[model samples]
Target: MPDIEIRQLKKDDVAAFKAIRLEALEMEPAAYASSVEEWVSLSDDEWASRLHMPVFVAFKSGEPVGVMGLLRQKASKMKHRSTLIMVYLRDSARGQGLAESLIDAVARFAAESGVLQIELNVSSENGRAIRFYERNGFRAIGLIPAGMIQDGAEVDEVIMARRLT
Candidate 1:
């Protein structure tokens, strides 16, 4: 294991955030709903605004290696839940426990914010990710057929959730 530091990304860290995030979007197109083209087109202010959310970034040797974000449900009826988003780990950083560290960071933040459950949707084709989530206490509750389409190819999505309370 390397000297890994997991911390919340701040507005001032836009450059570092963009670098790692753009890499994720490009490297794993099937893993994320957002595309590199869409994220790359964002203006500086747009990127800065996104940092306001609780986005946890993993840093190794002062460089970002993984990221995970939390989005709390805003509707009055769904206030106790949060959706985990934008999870990614660089190839060099995988299998070193950095991904789990990122998840733990988001889980702690979500629980602290009064969130009782955290949910996520992972591409069913991504077996490694599915296993990782299962190991982290998330259980598959449902599946959406043809949930995502990458390059005109349909992919199923697995819905998983973990309780914080």
Candidate 2:
């Protein structure tokens, strides 16, 4: 751990968020649902509006290297739950415990927002991510077959959840 700084991203940090997000999509095509093309096609305002959600970015030596976001359920009945999204770390930043740091930041934010549980969908082919989530106390609750299709290939998604309360 080299003094990694994890902070909640604000609207002013749109560019930083976009860069790291696009890098995530491009570097690991199968890891995320969003594509680099989709992100690049967004307008300035569209990009800014996305920062409205809780997005946390990891900074190593003043440069953003990783990101993780939380989307709290809007429905009143499901307010206690939130979906984790856009989790990624640059190849250079992996194995330095930066990913866990980002998750810890999100967990703190979610716990403060009255969220009882945090859930995420991981591609079945990404065993590394699945294991990482498991080490962080997330458990596989279910599986969705053909949850994502890319380049004419279907990838299953594993649903995992961790209770905060």
Clashing pairs in 2: none
Query: Per-residue alpha-carbon lDDT of model 1 for 12-123, expressed as tens digits?
Result: 9999889989999989988999899999989889999998788889999999988988888999999999999999999999878889888988998898899999999999
* TM-scores for the candidates: 0.97, 0.97
- What is candidate 2's lDDT per residue for 89-139, written digit by digit as tens? 998998888899899989999999899999999999999999999999899
Give the TM-score comparing model 1 with the true structure, all chains together: 0.97
- TM-score of model 2 (CA atoms): 0.97
Candidate 1: residue 19 lDDT (0-100)? 91
Off by over 4 Å in 2: none
What is the Å distance of residue 86 in model 2 from its true position?
A: 0.3
Candidate 1 — which residues are off by over 4 angstroms? Answer: none
